[model samples]
Target: MTETAIAEHGLIGDLQTSALVGTDGSIDWYCCPRFDSPSVFGALLDEHRGGRFRVCPTGTAYTTRQMYYPDSAVLITRFHAEQGVGEVVDFMPPAGEIATGRHRLVRMLRCVRGRMSFGIEVAPRFDYGRRAHTTDVTESGAVFSAGQLALTLHTVREPEDERLARVRVEDGDMRAGLDLVAGQVRGMILESGADGPPREVRVADFQRLFDETVRYWRSWLARCTYLGRWRQVVARSAITLKLMTYAPTGGLVAAPTMALPEQVGGERNWDYRYTWVRDASFSVYALLALGFSGEAERFGVWLGDRIRERAGGAGGPLNIMYRVDGSTDLKEEILDHWSGYRGSRPVRLGNGAAAQLQLDIYGEALDSVFVGDRAGLEIPYRGWLAIREVLDWLAERWDQPEEGIWETRGGRRPFTYGRLMSWVALDRGIRLAMAHGRPAPLERWTRERDAIYEQVMRQGWNEDRQAFVQHYHTEVLDAALLRMPTVGFVAPRDPRWLSTLDAMDAELVTDSLVYRYNPEASPDGLRGQEGTFSLCTFAYISALARAGRLEHARQVFEKMLTYANHVGLYSEEIALTGEQIGNFPQAFTHLSLIDAALTLDDALDGPTGPATGR
Candidate 1:
């Protein structure tokens, strides 16, 4: 059996949920109904235990290539062999509440030229493959069942190329694809329906749904605000992030699937399929800044709800992260039954990091709230109170040590970036209070902010190293500090900060990719070596541009773009060997890219690249 890893796949979603489509034309991971839903396609975890749906050209000699439609979310995969070329374009429409059946993964194929052969393997293991599945094939495709979960796939005509690959039975070649003709209708139930979801779909019915999916996506893109040199790349990344968003609650999962290792056969693997308060906050600025306030506003609403719910709790602020639907009951567990991705052991399902105190998220959460408030995204009066309440709570608890931004398993320490962002939380709150004339503890907040600033400068900096260390008294450098200027904490060119920047360049820069911190220097409580952080690399570009090193920064930014996967997607980290590490198409990385690109464009065009209305 051919094996596929999660990070090796490209993600395509319809804004409500997403699926991991492997390079070889198999969907290895996906969740139905929502981003945090149980796996309907779990092949990424254990190719043997977890199931998958694949359509591939016959012949081991066949080479595979893939790309996304320019400026759109449609993904096309081509298989080339001596016999001929076969292609598959996979996608789902982005409209809400369509035909609404069990979620679908529509595949279409086309013979590019001479006769070719292909195969289809529709084996689905529901509920993380803890149960057995029964497959029922019909005229269209097949319906897969295991327990209460049901996932039905729809295909057309006689799919005779068993395993979806075989040359002998073909007159021409396998020619099919998820409809992308702009008017094809496509939608899925995502939940088991009456009679346990229809076993298959009619060809005409599938065609209509496919057309609808295309129209839905096109209409949504019409509202995109990006018009940059990398417009197609940026817009598609934006859409990918949006598609991964769970619509009902406005929560965006960090990534669509779980257990995609950060390193090949390494223990750096962890699940990323949940809403991160920090990531959501950053996403607002990215979307709103790029003229997609619709997305930002949606996220803002979700954040507000979360803030309100958490305010009503004993902690008086919030949990660091939550399930897409705001469930705070994520208990991390290992699926010992299935082998991990790439033989990386301890495949985690729910994230234990949730229980860790990542204080940085409070500031991040408030950052978006502040921005959304300014951009006229309305907050309920009570919701506004909740936001202020969190700020007030932060005013007191900001100095506490917790898990740093990397969500390290290491014992919590005083992360300087966490402190820097705490300052941002207070700064923005103070501004909101003063500007809106809202009742607030401004005097206390200002004093607190000033005191925090004084403390950060005094201890957070290591005079000998001439750089702000990751923690007080430690000589470690952290890439998270690359946001020092972006968050308005300090001038990029301050002599001391400049010295710090130089120190970071010397200590942390590896071929222009920035490491979060030298793991060798600061053990993050994990054993495996990590890759250069993509987010930090982009931040380095932003920092360089801020320091007026535009040529160097622009070069770095351009080169960083080279690291993106073929579909213009990026994971959280880029391995030293150029493999994407961490989660596939991380939102934080893409947003930072947007920030870096915008900053560089401003340096080049004097803030006149393209105006995305506030």
Candidate 2:
């Protein structure tokens, strides 16, 4: 397989799970059944050991390009060779309301202008390439089986044609080739965990599924309420967020691919296939802003369950993150046998940061539920009581310090952002109780909230630097503090905030890209360094816009959009070289983009009204 750049890929998924298909015509990274499940194809991390399903034109020198079927998750990768032009359309049918332990990935090949020969390979590496698998190739397709995982690949063509008849098995993998002329087509459908004979799909069946899938995506996107500027980009981000959601439980994973490095040949790699409270809570606000109340309401129920499970128990109100099914057994493990992306070693599965103490989550959780409630998602009495219990639990322990939002392994300090969130948690909880006339302890919560405000103003501020430091001990600026204005903790144009923004502009912001924090000044117990955070950059744009710097904000936002990949997708971070790194199609980045776009649009319209009367 040709080496593919991380930015040269498009994403496709059912509501349950997603796959990353490269411009090179390879399904390089995919997890079966669920986003957190083991990989059926993972060549993005290790090209040799990590298996992949590749279908590309062979014996031809070609340049490739990729794009989404407009307003849909269906991805098309087009190949242009000396003799002809061909393309592959990839998609996964929507799982809809029912939750299942099975999934299907379809790839259709077409020669639009001339003749081209295509080669196909199916290699399955179960359990992160730690387990072996056996393959059976028949005339029609192939079946691959491991201990508990089975995948069947079906061929689709005209009954009278011989498009996929050249099947051969080699070294536990399946390989085949086919030739097609202009106006001819062939298809492949790979389904997970099927019983009895493999399901045979003809050309007509492929066309039916394709039409249904396209309709499903277009119909779903029609519900978006964002009619402001950047409509196309906002719609794409919304679709990406929906694709990351596990429809069964209404849980959203942070990203589909894991262990993509923050820095090439660096150890700053971690898994992001679990839901973080901070990420999901912010997602609720983004979804609600776009009129996606159903998603917000469902996430509210999922979050309410977490609170109820721990309302009367020990530990904090919630873990920093959780698995898709609301299970907390995310024990981190390292794949020592496989080489990491670009040799960034110790490719890890499961996030160890889930067990850390991050006080900011309370603020995020309460803020989400509060937003959902305001959007007409009613909080049942029992759920309200559980939320009250969580506030009560949080009120007692808001003072202490743990790892901050960055989840650094460095020892904890008095993180100012954490304190800001602690204040938000109490303030929102008190407002919820008062607005709905629910029973609660408002006096104690209000007192604590006021005290937290005082404490942050005093200790979190550094008089000499004229900026709020990352923590009490150091005079370092952090991009995470850009949310101070967005969360209502401080005014965007307040003298202090403007000064802090100026400080960050001098230190953290580079050509409009913002770094999370300077690790050189505040060593984060981790080796090497990282790139500018895409989420932080978007937040910076929001802060700029809210501060009445509309022209500058528009400039920064436009520049940031240029960093997005060809299909308007972003990874977690952007390398200094201007390429996307870290996990692909990150929810945090997309959500923040949506927020920034809305904020900028509102700012550009001024006090009269929105430009589109939205």
Candidate 3:
């Protein structure tokens, strides 16, 4: 089985798409055109068949370290050898308000001490390595062409005053050998397109791009109002969230790469390149907390469009997820041509849960709308009517069994988290009506919301466990319920919530890490043992802080920080060995991290312990 430590990587993006750069100086995973597009470099999943681009020291043994540039998405990977130190700076120039088909990955290399010899390799595997590509090499660089898809690599040397490097094409891959002395710099730009002709770029051009990318990031982060103790970490999370967002439509993907295993050698690998309603809604809250009201408002508009598009359709209120452009057709397929990550079989391409009746989305969607409205984003009259209709429709159907928050294929059960979110939807909707003086079925919403609360308190609670269970029929306690306080469903210090936290701490937590639930107690229709969920871990910290357990919360938060990759990026899960697992650079994890940091910071600063926003 081919394997690389999942945590040994950093992320760079242009808002529309992202790439994963391994610590060994290889672009292991990159999807062209867009986040959900076909992979141009899929070596992260199948090392043998999927292609990669590597630039690293070829003549010296070295130790590697990587970090992001302060608050920016730019990543720097340093190689330390006995005789010299070298670094590669990786970043994609941020695409402004305009949408375009061009996407570029820039790599700048320099030797800071002594001397170092470096090697470069560029291999392209189009359409997930199912098609063969032809490479044409010239004095400028090389272009790999497969049908309509083409990737051009442009190389630039310092100047005539410096020693020049030699590049050769071998075995359908571009190879380059260069020796750099101290303060010497070299660069390469990989551009993907259908129309752009291959050409050589000047060092001055690359210098301008680098400077502009840096300026863009610094200016963007300057808008942040978080002057808290955890500012650096919180800012990093914000930048990650921004990186994972689809700039054109303001849709936020759960993560950039897919088919990464939740469990090594397990069949739980999934595609998370699509936008999830639950994740995007929580992201809005995190962005708002960081004083990015424009992002929250734009996302609110996208979400409202989705709701309006599905209203009165046969598809029911809304699907759980959608394509970045709000399309609902996501056909899941297994790629039998490639070996999965770490030999985790059955690599999947698209999400099958898009059509699942995950009713919790309505609650999350309404909550986002409520948050946006509070942040002064106006809701159109038509938008309000569409939201009102969904709430009324939900009142009649919230009691039914459907796919829960986890989207488990085992079977639909009345998940308590689903019920809690349903109540949230109605509650938020009613509040919005009152706050905006909009026409709504206020009495019906209130009655349904109250009924949901009473039913949950009565049936969802497991008397034996002394906590809210995962579903009506199961004794399994889910860490997802950690959001109860944040959503205003229950007081953080309420006995019921405290009991739930205690139960989870005993059952689901391992050294401050949190498992979503015990699949042994409740099978999720997949055969695999998984890692502690990163998002759930953050939720646990937030809940603990809100409950006045500041010391416990602070300690857990600090430990969780250690789990982040060298560049402050987090994946979907963290293994028992403290390695990251599943789809990398997860937006859900980063957003939750922001929420947890903000909640904990407020608690630490205030005279009273964390206020639960009730």
Candidate 4:
């Protein structure tokens, strides 16, 4: 099996889709044209059946290290072998802002020290290995074709070396090996949707593309306004978020890979290559905090379109998630043939949670707009009307029991976090109307917001436990409640919030790694347990900082950073043994990292810093 550790990979993208390049010199996960498309290389989930494109130094006795090229998404994996030192640079050219079906991935290899032998394996099982493909080996490179999908591989060398240029196709796959001296280089370009065989290429062309890609990323990062204590980590998270963003639709995928189990051998694996309203809304705050106003504005426009369309059912104005293109055609299905990551069975595609009635999304939606508006993101008059209509509808049914933020399939409940966010929706709606002088039902919205606040205070709290429970029914603590102070639903120093924080600290915080909720105490209609959620841990850090626990927050923050993989990336969750075990390089984790960094920076800067309010 392609059993690379999840944390040993770095990410690179063209703003439309991305690939996970493991430090072992294998691109184990990738999707073409778009993030949600069927994988062309998915060895991350299955070994023999799922395909992979691997370029590594010959022999297994070499130490490998991976890192991003400074502030850019270009990933470099270096090999330290007894014979010599070599490195592979991997990157995707930015696809710009338009939607297209073409993409290019470039891999450049250089022998930095003495002569070293390298091997190339191109095994692409298209359609997730369901479809057979034909590979044609050529004198220069190779072409792999399967039905409508076609991939052309181009190879070029720095100097004419006939001995290192021969490649062959074996068992429907492409394979080659090269032995290069120091200062020699090899370039391989894999292009998707190739109309014809690639023409002759030169090493100079590859160098030009490499330089241009580096400049593209460095230029984009220049707009970051964060100059605080954790600038490097904050910047890394920002770049990760940018890499996950689909530029054409301004929608950020939750993460790039799917069916990577939260718990090893558990059945909780799910696809995350779609946009969640709740996650993107939080991303709005993080982006604006980093002074990436352009990104926040684009997402505001994308969300406004969702609001105007109103394509959801009883869950208010928007679906909990959608495709990067804003389409609601996600049909959850199982790939019964392909094995899941580490044998976590029943690998799934698409997401059934798209139709879930997560009422908290309304608040997250409006909160994003509100955050963006504060940064000069203006809503058109028609968009404002849609927001008003959504609020009016939510006003009547804000108290209805529905799925919470976790999308638990155990059935709906009047989740405290859902109600908290519903209150946020109305409260922000009222603020926006007053600030912009827009027409809105102020009386009804105010009444409903107050009612939600009062109801949560009364029914959602456990007087015996002296903490706010997950919902009104149980006394169990949830990390989601830690968001109360950040959204202004409750003051940071409020006694009730402090008690809830203390309760969470006692129950949910294990060495600063936070769990969303206890599955044993509160079953989620799923089999087996999950890891400590990375997003929840970062959110916990933010909450801790806001609650004036700066020392504890800093310690937890540093410890959490240690959990990040080799190249400073985090997955959806961390195993009890500290291995990342979910979707690799999740956007929610990075967004919360940015949020936590900003909050902690402000808290540590004392009273002379920017306002800590969201």
lDDT tens digits, residues 1-614, model 3? Answer: 76567788898999999899999999999998889999989888999888998889987789998888776889998999988999999999986555676889999988999999888889888999988888997766678988888888877774473433577766677777778889988878898763556666677888899889989999999999999988998899899899999988999999998899999999888899999999999888888888999898889888889888888666686889998988977899999988999898889999998889988898899888888888888999889989988998998889989888887899888999999999999999999999988998899889999999999999999999999999999899898889888898899999998999999999999999999999999988989799999999999999999999999999999999998888788999998788889999899899889988989998999998777653
TM-score of 3: 0.97
lDDT agreement with native, every candidate: 0.74, 0.89, 0.88, 0.88
Q: Candidate 2's residue-wise lDDT over 254-311, tens digit each?
A: 9988888999889888999998888998989999999889999888888999998878
How much is the lDDT of residue 390 in candidate 1? 85
Stretches of candidate 1 off by over 4 Å are 5-7, 95-101, 158-207, 607-614
lDDT of 4 by residue, 534-563 (tens): 999999998888888898999999999999
Candidate 1, position 145, lDDT: 67
Candidate 2: clashing pairs of residues = none
- TM per candidate: 0.90, 0.98, 0.97, 0.98
| Poorest lDDT segment (10 consecutive residues) of candidate 4 | 157-166
Give me the displacement of residue 500 in model 2, in angstroms: 0.4
lDDT of 3 at 409: 92
